[model samples]
Target: MPAAFPSSDPAIPTAPLTAEMRDALRAIVGEKGLIEDEHGKRPFVTDWRGLLVGGAGAVVRPGSTEEVAKVVRLCHQHGIAIVPQGGNTGLMGGATPWPAHTGIVLSLGRMNRVLDVDPVGYTMTVEAGCVLQTLQETASRHDRFLPLSLGAQGSCMIGGNLSTNAGGVQVLRYGNARNLVLGLEVVLPSGEVWDGLRALKKDNTGYDLKHLFMGAEGTLGIITKAVLKLWPAPKDVCTAWLAIRDPRAALEILSEAHSASEDNVGSCELMSRAAVDMVLRHIPGTQDPLKADTPWYLLLEWSSARARQDGAEGMSEKMEQFLADQLEAGRVLDAVIAQTGNQSRNMWRIRESVAEASRAEGPGMSFDISVAISSIPEFIARGLEAALDILPTIRPYPLGHIGDGNLHFSFMGPSGMDQQTLAQYKGAITRAVNDLVTSLGGSISAEHGIGIDKLDELSHYRSKTELDIMRTIKRALDPQNIMNPGKVLRL
Candidate 1:
């Protein structure tokens, strides 16, 4: 059996859910919506990584926005804490409820629905629980594209995407979830529903209220629905794998590609030798794209929505010429360009499989960080050196969207290091890397919000004034702190 929730405060009496409160919630969501059994609640209480296992008073699923609001109102009346959950694919422990705290898991999965799609307006109105991939496919059917692609897109819901302000490989061109949203429908801590789902591109009316809940991580409110921006689907896409001398060379190629391709570069990714090796080792049916092994590799893509003129070259031709120029300039030692759709998918699979492959190899401390594009090479060189200085046997496996300067800088413990030994180095390595990133004017938490994992780090790195402002907003919006308590801000 899973351990009971260990409380920090022993003096305060634990509040069990009363029959009246349960009846009220059940009335709002119906009998099928409320999950009270331990077996039924296990998936919602446990995080994806299995690192965080918590307990929830009950798991409630409300199908509609009205139902969700009513459930929140009932929880508010009863003074019961709420933990809004989405797909439960978050890297940070943002969606999981605290074991020490008593709350109901307010899951948005039942709210999954595509309300409207405006191809001409370039907008898509969707429920927060809509899966990212489903939205992407829906957009594709209308000859449009929702460029928010990620590894967990298959399961991660849009609500969690909005709450976390997630960033994916296409962030280099399309921006993060915060940029794609035009409006939001949120359930405030007071059980008040704030409906701001406008598809308009320009609305210069007062402060944009939607921004408040975009990356608030469920601390401010529960995101139930949203108005998302869409783009014309690309007609032509070119994917290429290049073996570069180092990170600096990859950056150089990125600069040249933009100029040569007339800024059609859709994605630019950097992968280390170790990261590639990890993928080939753990992932089946995957072969190295290039014969010669280099210290680093770059996965570059160029895409165009417009069709090619009758006698003109297309994106593929342009990418080929760009790669030729780089090879001649010694920036790219070797390269391979995908000639078919299957080939392109295969190439992307290698890049997307990095996380899974790394996990299969061993436990490691991972960081999602970003610095100025110009300082990426410096940050990688100095940060890796600093980490190696601390523990010489450490394996640095850093990879990410280089165009935006966000790197999933992760380090695998030395071979045969037990879990206990690995835990000892996590803190020191994280601090050393974070210090280097901060000194170079970078953010410690780039795409991933500060869940429980980085709460203390945020307190340490963020300025007192900045922290005070965050707290002030939290207090004004969620004075009761009943919404996802102990997340984003410490009480």
Candidate 2:
């Protein structure tokens, strides 16, 4: 194991599962619901990155909220730890257990069920384990739209999305996962269900407890169900790929885009030529939408609910005029509007495939950081300079949701450099990048929560008063520290 990941924490219970405990777990979840063999438990303990592999006593799949409560109660009674999982698709090691864990991996996969869809109210109540793509499709069938979307949506569950407070491309318009949720039902550390699953637009109840579990990353409680807010389905839409002059030009174009697009901008993604090429190299059948000499590129999208008429001007016409003006003004070097659905899909495929391509290419590090929208260009420029100053050979492949100011600052290892060699420079590079971010008043973590990967980073950057409040809440809810111990906080 890496030195950063320790097998045990003093506050967390590490009692091994004995025969009686195993029997009790099996009895609660039944034989079909339990996986005791190593082969069966491997995937649950392994993180999405395939690094940070941990250990679990057994894997438990509960079919309903009641069953989940019982399993949690049983574990609580025995003073055993519990790691709640939705899809096991998290980039951070939030769902993975510790190597010394004697706890059960409680997966909510079988509890996936769309409880209700209220089109009139623009709300959908669903079990947490429902796949994000499935929920999108369900909402689409009702002529409503679920705005939460990402590269992992095909496999990632809604519960994990909410737990991480995921930010996707649509966040430029609709906002993050937490913004889309109206209420949530969570199972506390004590196995008590806190039912806040109401479809109300206005609820000023005490504390607004649902917000606590949404971004807690399973450290406070397990999100079992949620009432999701929806939007009207988009009709006329336009997607254009532009090779911009630079990051500053990209921001200027985006600033003018809102008024040009009539405030219908859906997404504005900033991509470097290196990141685009990396995606095309690894993701099969993905074709480059446009090729230009500029290093910076922008994928701009606009959508409106009103359908295009026979001859009336629509999103495409407006976007075409905007691009022409930008090109004349020197902000855009070259551009191409996706003329077909396949072309538009190709553009999205390149953007979304960046993550999968990075994984396949091997031995790389990425930081999901954010700053003020205006500070993004300056941050990126200085951020890259600081990193290259440390190691010039470190290949930079930066990309981002420029409209929202979240950048996935990433880099692959220098050619021919092995994992061990790259690991040596990680500490220095991470410190440099994070230090720059802190100095600029930017966040170290943007959409991804402070899971195992950023536990220490959070402590280092956050004020003592903030951390003390968080620790107090964690201890109050889980005095035993049995809820995902040794993952988020040192305690």
Candidate 3:
């Protein structure tokens, strides 16, 4: 039986969990699955960055999809809100609950399991709770690769990745998490399970509901499982680090390289000298890539399945010649091509370690924005120049998948500044940078989803027409406005 609400007060009731709700929920999931104490529920209630804090009546860990459906149905009956959580590695506070008093934290971490691997079909059926790194390893066991590589692969779950449509290093080649998904198993707000877990490469079904849920950030429904596309592991790969003169030169080089080899090119990442300095100063075992100093650097990679270099057509040698020509043409300042596998790994490590290095450097606001590939050079120059005018000491670490035009533009406060003072300037820096990005017709958020962090910015960026469409869809899907109440588009 559902708990009866107080007729007198409209605000969330302060009443404890009813006996009926507790017993019924425990019956569906064993005692081991329910987390009622503060200690046991601590991890699931907070996000990865500790930016948002939330409270929950209880944290329920369902063991199966069926159990998830049952829990949703029960919560709906009792007017209790449910916040679905996976590995809790989200940067935007999507998995974390709002400060509401009526929601329950529903964790999918216990439901992790690789359901099936179809090597012939080149697909893998996995539960939403499966860790991305483990899934990659499982695919590798079958001589295939799940190419959605990211920093949080070891801790971020596939469900959260799909929810955010996460883009990582390989996004330049494989696209975002949405691109890698074939199908999904979703539990709707009404407790109905929509199972679309078919592993077909071509399925032109009506509406394509999977995509709606892909980057929805769990605003529409809770994802229970997914069918992910896989690729045959590359037989040969070459990774190299090049020192470039400027962002304009980097963009030019990327255009030239992509013209030389189409999809064979894997990743093209940009890191400014200022960004590299933070990595070297904060991250131990980090080294400069080039022997000579340059304004910026680029990390480029090539992937091929065939081991043959075609006698006269050596990929590495050809790439070397291309760089040499560019250097002679005065487009490239300097370059260091990785000759061995260890060297390649070491070079990539520096790129991956930029975020941690920034934190150690100081407190600052982070912006993951995208602009036209051709317009990035101007955007960076203009944005950095404007921000520096406000605080001349502000150091901008503008780096990321420049091949795709997505840049992680970060601001580090002046030297020896206290955390309190740095915190005060976050909004001014964010607004200034965002305004510049918007003026250039760039997306405010390229990869990260709009959780609570960017709700206001989303409104400013989206026009009246687009905002109306999003609101209509939200009202139609969640009429009661209970599913992730304050997310993406405001309610």
Candidate 4:
């Protein structure tokens, strides 16, 4: 069920929108672009995670970058807030409309397009609405690779990825969306377009403004399009699922595998036995990666260019041999190395289905956090201890892109624990976990971002000086606080 909001809230703008305002907005975008029906805006009104359900004055599906710019310009002119959205696959509730409904949702889903693909330059210029998988396929057509592979790649937009600076499985090697982006085309709060779409390797001309909006969560401006950097397609690929005793052993095994395969290690994800069990139990056709139920598992990948591979020099054999050594050394419990592409994909299916499988369990509080690679084990130990102490019956589902020191810490409720009760204790639990994370020199938010869901927590974790500067920038760019207002930072 969708979460409910308080009827009497200060943030919600209760003042009605005048007929003159609607006419002015409709004139900027076409009549067809304007969506007035409450039912018509229902789908776009709520967030993907179902954490935040809101109402908007109207939904405007912009067809082009210019149309988006015009809509933003009009919102700015009237001091109305604007929430730019893409596929709405965000977990942070960043794209959800405000209850104030004082704003309009700028949906760029209609602007989906691959404007240009330069195989020679190893870059692609795409609209914000282009699906991640589409971008990957388009890159593959030219014998290149767009390595930002997230679970939501099938439905999420490149715009949302860029906005979140998304880090997926490949972050262990390819880095996040911020690294993949070479240039960006954004629409400022003032309704002006800043086209910094130069796909250059090194251009230190002035301030690198792109980085500011990359993870700003749309608080500053709206990202309309972007030029993403790609890489040469890897020829030889290897995937393996190894059973480790714990996160410490998983990290140790990852270290050994990297030594044997060099930096060819593309992805090294850590998964708990419980996490894998959830997938096998809930996800259809999903089976255990290994025969025995170990305490933890590691999904390892090694990719190399075609020219780099030689006969009898496959990395899988080396990876398997290393795992064998670790098993003998008591570092690992058991392991299964994929012999074919299909088998490798099957193993990945277990890792990727974690989120969905978790949902089948029950309503819970989810956390995306990160710490130094070496500090992860301690963080987990302390975090789990803290969480269990607070919610004894809470099932701890700890998993994530461990290679990046990030973990998706979730607490599954036992039978009969209503979501409302869980939600009521959410702040206390998050504070407990975040306090531990902060003490370990870690971040409260790893990859998900500080959308509306964690805005208060962000303010809690961030220093006053840092938040002051962020507010200064938001006010400087969006004086009226109309562009994605009440999101990342609120004045």
Model 1 global lDDT (CA atoms, 0 to 1): 0.87
What would the per-residue lDDT of candidate 3 be over residues 402-433, giving only the tens digit for each residue?
A: 98889998878788876667766766777888
Give one digit per residue, the lDDT tens place, for model 4 in 1-491: 76654323325223445688788778877898889998888888788766678878888888888888887887777777788888898888788876766668888888898999999999999999999999999999999999999888888999988888899999988888899998999999999999998899899989999999999888788888899998999877888888778888878877777778867889988887778887888989877768775677788888887554456667766676777799898987877788877788889888888777777877887899999888889988988988888888888878888888989987677678888888777767888999998998899888889877777888888999999999898879988777776777657
- What is the alpha-carbon RMSD of candidate 2 to the true structure? 1.4
The per-model lDDT (C-alpha) reads 0.87, 0.90, 0.81, 0.83
Preferred candidate (lDDT higher): 1 or 3:
1
| Superposition TM-score, candidate 2 onto the true structure | 0.98
List TM-score per model, in order: 0.96, 0.98, 0.93, 0.96
In model 1, residue pairs whose N, Cα or C atoms come closer than 3 Å (at least 3 residues apart or on different chains), thus clashing, are: none
**Rank ordering of all candidates by lDDT, starting from the highest:** 2, 1, 4, 3
List the candidates ranked by TM-score, beginning with the highest.
2, 1, 4, 3
Residue 142, model 1: lDDT of: 99
Supply candidate 2's per-residue lDDT for 262. 95
Q: Enumerate residue pairs that collide in model 4.
A: 13-100
Selected candidate, larger TM-score, 2 vs 3: 2
Better candidate number, 2 or 4, judged by TM-score: 2
Best by TM-score: 2
Give the 10-residue window scoring lowest on summed lDDT in candidate 4. Answer: 6-15
Residue 466 in candidate 2, Cα distance off native in Å: 0.4
| Model 3 / residue 174 / CA error / Å | 1.8
